[model samples]
Target: MQMLQLSAEAYWGVIAHAQAAVPLEACGLLAAVQGKDLVSEFFPMRNAAESAQLYRLDDAEYLQVEQIADARKLRLVAVMHSHTHTTAYPSPTDVRDASAFDPFGALLYVIVSLKHVDPVLRCYRIVGGQISEVSVEVQW
Candidate 1:
């Protein structure tokens, strides 16, 4: 099984962004030291889709974030987004989008679900159209 380690700050940053974007999906990028699985930074990004059920990282924003990560010597670990009315599972659209965007299956996809009273965060790896859950470890 795969695992993603996140710093406490990064964990809360994701939740805060998700809640703040309520009604519309929020998206962001996760970064960590090169070749490591522990995430040390979260880059909140504008959702180009701007829809409650869909999300797209703006092209310019994506490039900017990539540059920042490169300068910091960090790897782009994953792409995160929120689901306002669903569980913390990848939707069909998510699967399709992942395949289209990440053909090499390099980045993990993290989903934050706000359907219930409590928020749920789940990580996944979508490769070759197959979706598999990845465990997340929140470090203090």
Candidate 2:
């Protein structure tokens, strides 16, 4: 299986962002060294959809984050979002919206579900409308 190595700070950042979103789904970007699977940074963004069930990264925020990543010599490797009332799995909407969403081809998708007391995070790769689980390797 494919693996996504995430820094502990980045992991917590994602979780905190998700928790802050509360009723609405949270969303963010993961940055890594070009062509690498290691996530070195997390960039939290406002959920444009503003819905409890779904998330949409604001286009302006996305561009700003992209520029920040580029300046840091990192490339955006994945998109992370939270599911407030559902499991940490991609929804039909996610599958449909993810295809060709990244100009750099398919992107890793990290979903955090706050449906339970302990949040569950899952990784996936959605390419050509197919969803495949990816192993998440947390790095301290």
Q: Of the candidates shown, which would achieve the greatest TM-score relative to the real structure?
A: 1
Off by over 4 Å in 2: 103-105
Which model scores highest in lDDT?
1
TM-score of each: 0.97, 0.94
Cα lDDT over the full model 2: 0.89
TM-score of predicted structure 1: 0.97
Q: Candidate 2: TM-score?
A: 0.94
Clash-forming residue pairs, model 1? none
Q: Which digits, one per residue and each the tens of the lDDT, describe model 1 over residues 43-136?
A: 9999999999999999999999999999999999999999999999999999999999998889999999999989999999999899989999
- Ten residues in sequence with the least summed lDDT for candidate 2: 98-107
* Candidate 2, 3-103: lDDT as tens digits: 98999999999999999999999999998888777798999999999999888899999999989888888988789999998999999999887885753
